[model samples]
Target chain A: MELSLFDVVGPVMIGPSSSHTAGAARLARVARQIAGDFVRVSFGLHGSFAKTGWGHGTDRALVAGALGLTERDERLRDSFEMAKAAGLEYDFYTADLDVPHENAVKMTFFSADGGRLDVVGASLGGGRIVITRIGEYPAEVTADAPTLVIVQKDRKGMVSQVSQILAAHDINIGVMRLSRTARGEVACCVIETDGELPDGVLGEVRSVPGVLSARSVSV
Target chain B: MYSCFADVERLCAERGIEPVQLFVENEMRLTGRTEREVYDRMDARLTIMEDAANRALSGPLGSVGGLIDGLAQAQWRYAQGARTLCGAFLNRVMARALSCSEVNASMGRICAAPTAGSCGILPAVLLTMQEQYALPRRSVLDALLTASGFGAVVMKNATVAGAEGGCQAECGVAGAMAAAAAVQLRGGSLAQMLSAFSLVLVNCMGLVCDPVAGLVQVPCAQRNASQAVGALLAADMALSGQLFPIPADQVVEAMARVGRQLPIELKETAQGGIAATRRGREIAREILHRERA
Candidate 1:
């Protein structure tokens, strides 16, 4: 993905966290893409990022941005102050994940309608970003691209069956990442493929047995 | 159809230009922006980064708790020197690279290519070579053009985003570009430039994008220092006639493969590596707690 100065460079941001402090918040907001309105968010920060997260304003940034704010949004700094005003109910926690990154954040957001999303994000520096998890999928999706994220049941021949279908249409999947959900019954595949998603692929994927829902993201 | 260094060299010789210069000219054509424009954007951004660093460092602190202070202070000093030498009006890329180092910083705001994370590597290597060799500005410009060409090739075939690939994509690619540019500066033919480009990529492929706490401090700052040094080394080797077992194109393809295989946590998610460690986690908590307090 191509990053502009506004994309990688910061200052129109809240303090403390760019990846977790600010980006964690942005990831929550983007999580709304799958979860929809009326959401409950649980934020988990890994060890070091967690310790300094508050001072970095990550909690506020995540909450505020979750309530709907952009990195360039002026209100990002005051997101915490505005959370009460916005009536956002949220919880923050710390965890020791056996991951190598020093600034990782995971947010699991549930919509009122039973729709939910799990987003793992990292701030890669210069305000650059990467979304590493969605639901239970282990893939890297850019919040800056047009992406297709599919959540489905894990079954034999699933990938091949889907790959054959995509290849038939001459669509090249740039980067395909799959992670089994917590339940292990389902798997989420995040595809950062080149070109636009064909209009009806979501419906087609949804029709597949064990396929829960397929969503397309353009940010 | 054309795959080897010889093919690229032959093309460059036929075109009456060095191999690296061909890359630069091609980059200019593809971006649809002039060399001056790219330079200007990079220059401008450097100024902004320097000013921000200064603002961040205004007050004296307790003991240096984390990495931000050291990197920001270094960037501040580097920026001041860059502004003095390159003038405030240089290109953003040039300015940013110079500002990150003392001798070459520019005088203004500019655009940062690939990213602002390792902005200093490219210009620091290229400009220093220019001064050291006493080459004309045009020669240096050709080298930059060549580097841009290689950079665009990577952008097309693989990835440059630290988020997608890793710091390898950022500093690594910068080093590759600089190596090719340096080859041109040394008057190496196109084949030599390609050798340099390939050599750099082979060594840097698969390097991770693990920025600590996502601050652009820790690894990003220190990484820039190493990246600049690496680019110079790669260029020097290429100039001296080192050969790579792998092709440049193949190395780029390997980088893409590595980026794909990279765990999401390693590819800039900050979920893994140093970003997720006990110390990294503590620093994050401390920052958050301080904010809340």
Candidate 2:
């Protein structure tokens, strides 16, 4: 809880609402990372995000975020037209996530190659967001700092191997969570770091044995 | 986890400096940023706040909901030639507060000083204080740093989210934050800053978050303007040796408790207060339908 002054005073952003707009955009950005390239995406709104999201521009903000725009980007208001021009199709619907968080959304991203990614996140107000679930891998990623998400075979020592590589780069791991659907099947390791893993760290993590994909995203 | 007002006081005492120094050190230590980096970022935010206010004052009528369109500029017109009520300085405060609030409603870029709903309060107070006192930008940024410390404390001990703690948490905290910032800019002591903080909370406690139709228009804009004035007045009280009977920390605790006790209808649910009125319901429906179309 070492809150920065920026947390209390800033995040210079465009908004009708921070939770509904800026937080929505951050959630979408994280989801897009897990989602890969997509042609169509359906946003499953939950709780308050569905009820009053329209007025807050949650839909447009999410689209703009998925298109890879930062929260402060001036293009956020014109996101709908930009999405259409980019040939990206999207829809919004109320979804029953059965989660208690008042502001949540689940996204289903469908790539042209038939690959699909499902991500669930909650907008925790004041432009803060957390990616709660990514394709059945329960994890927490706030994107407050450099975050590395590694999908790999849930073999023993995978965590240590990833940690060793990061340690090699002198990047301190702030918080890490490992979630697997089954024993030795598949796992997602969400490593939140203090300093960013220097360039080429993602490629190194991807090349590690048993690792499927690795991606780094930051706010 | 330097979370509360006590932490700030401790840091200031340990370092033998003021809240401004504490702000810079805390931010640097918290984010691993350099001193220059920290000031540059704060300076950028101040620029945005000023820019938002300027745009709203000079741009065309731009509120998305048309509720607060041209409000800041309109006040400027009203301030001219005998329509002046509270003198030019106070009028400027209200106008500037509306300017930033209207900027927010129109989807213009602005710094969320704690949150967007209460964004106008600090800028209005600090900018107006600068205009009156002839303070430079550096002094204003210092005040902003001081205000951020106050905000960080309230955020830690209580809540700043309207949905969680009502408008008392949002506007109330903003006023308190602005009061302390105003005191800092005017060179008030730490004790005086604390007194001003308590004054704001004691005065504006238990305010409901009943934004009409759940939009940050209507009372939200009005509250920003009023809260700015309230903060400045509180600063004056602290400067004049007026003190709050209760301490600032206790006032924050009471504010949080009162917010929790408020009915859900009054807490941005849009099901009560002004949001529950017939016109409020109609406005909600109209906004929803218009967006759908």
Candidate 3:
């Protein structure tokens, strides 16, 4: 590797833990976009993050962020109180997992209109976050644009059918991951196709009898 | 914004931007404080750390903790000694009063790339390098600019949440950012800077976000201490003419991948690692129960 002075010291930021607090705020904000308003949030902490969520203020930061707060927002402490003040409810819990990450959080957010989303996200060091799960499905998709998360039945040709529609529009799938429930009765296909999913594509896919629900994420 | 270390150097050559000028502007943007304020904060924080180390050293403690205390004292003294060469390194102590004390008191501040509890690592390293290298403050400023850009990329690319990616994203990234700056300070080329970053990322990858008792006071401080050493070592590797096999992009991507594989408990939930303990959890419950009562 070629050496440069910039590589040694790059940026300045807040501290204690960047990935846990900053990334959690961003994750909660993203979750808010999908979860919508008038919802409840329940956060489950794993490993070290779980043990010190309150002390590290990870839980408060997440809740504040879910309510639309940024890392620099002075109201974050109040943001937690504001949730209840705004009639928003939330809870916190802890779970154990045999994993390498010492910092992990599983957040379940509920929307008022019967929309429920569960996001399992991890804060890698350096204030970075990855959303690994949405609900029971493997929604570990990238935040890149033109992505579609389709909750559909576990049936043959379903993926190809969706691909065909996307292909017809000249849309390319950058990354795709599919997972099914343990019972195998339901499955989800999350396609991070490039350049928008096309307006009618989502409606048409939803129209499919086997398709349960579909959502789009813009990077 | 800084795709490669070359970009930073190129900008310097093309725009005649000195490192100190760039450093000042970038410092203001990143910390919401002026260059003078940052200088003051740096001095104050280093002083505080030194005092803490001296106090800890005066007493008989475990070898590891004692060694850290002594090292910390030395780092502060080093910064203090270089104050003349790095005149900007000294400042009023009050400038660094914790901005998010509530978060730290009740929960804890997320010091983007620093230990939320310590919240002074990046600045500490930056100021120290400026003083130690006796480089033009302008050059240091430019390095700071490049570093902020790198930080933004990390914030966009991976994550900064310990709960999500663990302390790796926090202090790990901070160290990497600092390593990049250090390489630049040593007048290493772009390739060297990126190599330094690769070394920093690979070494600190997947560091968990377990804060004992949820307080940023304990392991958080220790983590910052280690992070400083890591940053220096990574920079030294690149400055010493050693090369990293992996590219910066690949290293960052691998970090993201590793973060994904880590269980939620380890990320920052305080559930799995240091957070989950017969004593730690009991303390948490007791605190919460006390709050309720």
Candidate 4:
């Protein structure tokens, strides 16, 4: 996407370092969207995020994001207390992850309803982030636009089916990535759209043949 | 593409339009947003910048690192005192710069003019200009759009990331952006605005981004204050018809070249410059220990 004047001038974020704080918060916020509602989340910091994330308030920012706070929320500073009040369990660990980026984190989230998810993302500075992985699938989700993540059985015409549904709804696809473990096995399709997916699009997608689960995320 | 100041100048000359007009139209074309929408968005950003610039003056803000707290309030008090060196306007400018940076360090909300680390400089100059001159909101917003134009050129030709180009990219470009905006706010000509932009880049070239403890405190906040002052001085020189030997686009390219030559240690790694000092190491260790505890 072309960089706008607004992109140059502002994200209007809670800050100290854009990469460590604002970007970290955004990465976690996107992770939350991908993972859905979670009662507990653990952040595994890597490289610079592990080295100086504490001082830069990456931990607090990450926690705030897990609680669904936007980067501009002033409650970011007191996010730990807010998390406590919200009954959101959180933990931070310095982990050795073989990520290319210095500002990376691996997050695992658990819900009281026995749902679990794993997301790994990196802060690419200036409050930008790329979610590199979701669950066991390698992914590239930037959250720059509204996105749909679909888990499905690797089968013929799955992409065409999803694209047709989106086309039927007048949602234009900007970028799409499809990955799978092996032929006819489980696969993940991540599609970023130019227009918002109207209500019931997810239901329509989930009802597609061989589709396992689907979620829509916007940031 | 608005790739350079020379292009901006040539276009303005060809069309006999102001830089803000060109910028606003370009934004409209690029984003498919109306002029009013663009202006309203910028006004919202201005509101954010204003809030961040003023928040720390009312009370001390504690930083997450425990490295910088109450410094902006202290500067505010000093600015308010009977005896100070920078006079009332510049002192408050410095204080507001510090205030925004302090708010940033404390994880308060702020607009990242280019990057969060240098968020203070532009808002400090623009807000102080508005306050001192009672400038119209339209004028301040125009100045902001003008600044973003210059910043976009820098981003196109070079960068604004400290990790990629050191503090020169973050704070230096921010100072240049602020200087250009200040020149516009003062009704200076396009040449003067470009001159101010070039002067700031020349003055702040090769500045490193070695935040102590790898945190955006200590030197970062002070650098914002000093660069805010530098931006004002650059604008003053430009408005007075002073010119640089090198053109603004070349200056931005030079900054990019110098930034590329900077070692990784000096580029936000916290492994060189002040971050490498013995005391800096001690502070890092202490902060880490405290956090672990």
Candidate 5:
């Protein structure tokens, strides 16, 4: 998509650093949307995020976002106390992860029901983020538009079925990517739509044969 | 997209329209939003800038890294007193710039005009102009639109991230944006506005980004204030009939080239310039010690 005038002019964020704080919060919020109601989160920061993240309030920003706070929320400064109150345990580590970007983080979230999700993302300056990996599937999810992240078995006609369901709802696909571990193995389909998916579309997607899980994320 | 100032100038001259109108119409076409929606969104950003510029004037504000605190209030106090040599207008401009930067460092809500590190320059100029000239709200908003157009052109031609292009890309572009807005607010011609924009860039070329301790405090806040003053002076120069030899688009290209040539240590890495000084390293170590404690 082309850059807008507003993108040059404003994001209306809480900040000491836009890439470190606002972008960090946004990345965490996207992670929260993907993995709902996690009980604990561990952040493995790399490069600049590891060296200066604390001074730039990256830790607070990440915790605030994982607690479901927006970037502009004033409570971002008090995120640690709020996380304690919310019973959302979090830990930060300076990991030596090999990432191309200077501002990257690998997050592992644990849910109360023994479910776990791994997400790796980078803050690509100016309050923009890209979720690079979800679990074992390498992905590129910007959350710029309403997106559907579907995890299913790598089988024939899976893409056709999902596209047919979305086409039935009048949702135009802006961009779509499919990734799998191997042939006929677990796979991930990331589809960004031009508009929000109508209610019950996700349910229809989940009910599809061989579809393990389907989640909608909009920012 | 409106990528170059030369094209913008040509289109404006041919159509006999202002930059603000062109930008608003382009926004309407791109976002598929009504004119009212675009203006309302910009107006909301103006409100946030106003809050940040004024929030730190009355009291001291603390930064996240503990490197600097209450400097905005100090500047405000000095401006209010009779001791400043630059008179009330410039003093208040610097104070407002420092105020907004201080608020950003303290994790207060702010509108990042181009980026967070340089958020203070544009708002300081616009708000101070409005207060001093008693300009109408509509005119100030129009000036803001003009600045956004100038910024969009810069973003298309060059970089705005400090890490990519040094402080020149962040603070220098911000000053240029403010200078263009100032010219528009003062009813200058399109040529004059572009001259002011180019002059600001020329004045701030090659300024490095070296925040002490990798926090957006210290030199960054002070640079905002200095660049706010620089923008006003550049606008005044354009209004007074001074001409810059280079065009605005060429200046932006030159800035891009210079930013690429700057060393990595000088580009927001906190490893060179003032950040690498003995005192700078000492301050970084102190902050690290405190964080560990």
Candidate 6:
């Protein structure tokens, strides 16, 4: 991604370190969006996030994010207290992800409606983050982009059909990745676009012949 | 992204405006926001910087690990004494910087002017100037934009990551940004601002990123605070007609090269420098044991 002036001068956030704190918050925020109405979140912090995260407020930063707070929210200092008031149940565990990236976290979100999602993300320095995994699927998507995330039955023409819809809408695809747990069983497709998805694009994707679910997260 | 500083300088010259307009335009293109949106957003960040620094100066807080705290108060005491080495203005710069750094160490909210570890430099310098000289808030924001312009240039040309380049990339670049902004805020021309920016980078080049115990406290906070003084001195020298000789772009490249020459142990690994010392290791272990509980 081209570096912006704000990327250099801003990302105004609560911080002792941008990666450990701000990016961690961002990871949790995305996880929050993925797992709607989550009641319980088990955070498996890895490497540097597990070792020194306590001192850097990574723990609280994650809690604030799950509560739908931005990094700049001044009430971030009261996240722990506010979380309790909001009736959110969460836990933290030290994780070993077999990865070298120092700032990593695995979040398991349990929604009140009996949905469970597991996400692994890394804070790639400077408050930028990548959602590296979703459930049993290996995926790569950045929060900096307007993205379409789809989980579907793995079969022929799934990639082509999805691109056709996006191309039809004049939405330029910046990046697209198709990763399946195994061939012809289940797959995840993450599309990052140059323009915002036109309204109702998610419904069109969901109505596709073989898609299990579709969601678009706007930047 | 811009490849070098000369490109930025040339763009600014052709536009017949300060480097700040370059930053504003670039921000608009990159973020797709209007000029009002960009400046207003920056104004909000500027407000946060001042608020965090002021909170720190109003009272000191113990760092989370308790390594450095109350030093701002001690500095204030020394500044109150007769025949101090630096005057009250410089003392306030240090105090403001220390306050923000110390606040950051305590996990208080602060702007990551470039990064959190070096957040204090620009704020300390600008907020101090805002109070001492009564510069308009808009002008302060413009200085911040001037700082941001060079900041983007350096981040693009080289590396700003301590793990990639060392303290020279983090605090070093921050000092340069602060110096350039200070020059702009004080009515210096673009040439003087660039010279000051180069001078600060030239001075801070090759500084290691060996924070004790992999924490952003200790040397990090102190560096953030002291570099404000370094920035002011650079700005003063540039304003007094001193030249930095090397162009800003080459200086950034030199800093990047020097960073690669630094050993990994010194690049935020906590395995060398003060972090390898007995006290440093002890502190790390103690903090780890406590956190586990």
Which candidate number would show the highest DockQ if scored against the true structure? 4
Report the lDDT tens digits of candidate 5 across residue range A24-112: 99999988888766899999998889988988899999999998899999899999999999888999998876667889999999999
- List clash counts for every candidate, in order: 82, 0, 108, 0, 0, 0
lDDT of candidate 5 at residue B237, scale 0 to 100: 100
Interface RMSD of each: 8.9, 1.9, 9.1, 1.8, 1.8, 2.4
Ranking by TM-score: 5, 4, 2, 6, 3, 1
Please compute DockQ, using alpha carbons, for every candidate against the native two-chain complex. 0.05, 0.63, 0.10, 0.70, 0.69, 0.58
Docking class of 4: medium
Pairs in steric clash, model 5 = none
Give the per-residue lDDT of model 1 (tens digit) for A40-118.
Answer: 7777887655855543456666776677776545466566667777676678888765456766677778777787666
lDDT digits (tens) for residues B192-249 of candidate 1: 6667877777777788877565555556655666666666677778778886667787
Query: After superposition, which runs of candidate 2 have C-alpha atoms over 4 Å from their true positions?
Result: B1-16
Better of 2 and 6 by lDDT: 2
Of 1 and 3, the candidate ahead on DockQ is 3
* Cand. 4 Cα-lDDT: 0.90
**How does each model score on lDDT?**
0.60, 0.86, 0.61, 0.90, 0.91, 0.84
Candidate 3: docking tier: incorrect
Residue B46 displacement (Å), model 5: 0.7
lDDT of 3 by residue, B148-254 (tens): 55655565567655656787876687778778877878778767877887788899887887755555544555566566567778888899998898767778878
Name the weakest run of 10 consecutive residues (lDDT summed) in model 2 chain B: B57-66
TM-score of 6: 0.90
- Candidate 1 versus truth, CA RMSD in Å, comes to 10.0
Error of 3 at A69 (Å): 4.3
Error of 6 at B86 (Å): 0.9
TM-score of every candidate's chain A: 0.71, 0.94, 0.75, 0.95, 0.96, 0.91
Ranking by lDDT: 5, 4, 2, 6, 3, 1
TM-score of each: 0.50, 0.94, 0.53, 0.97, 0.97, 0.90
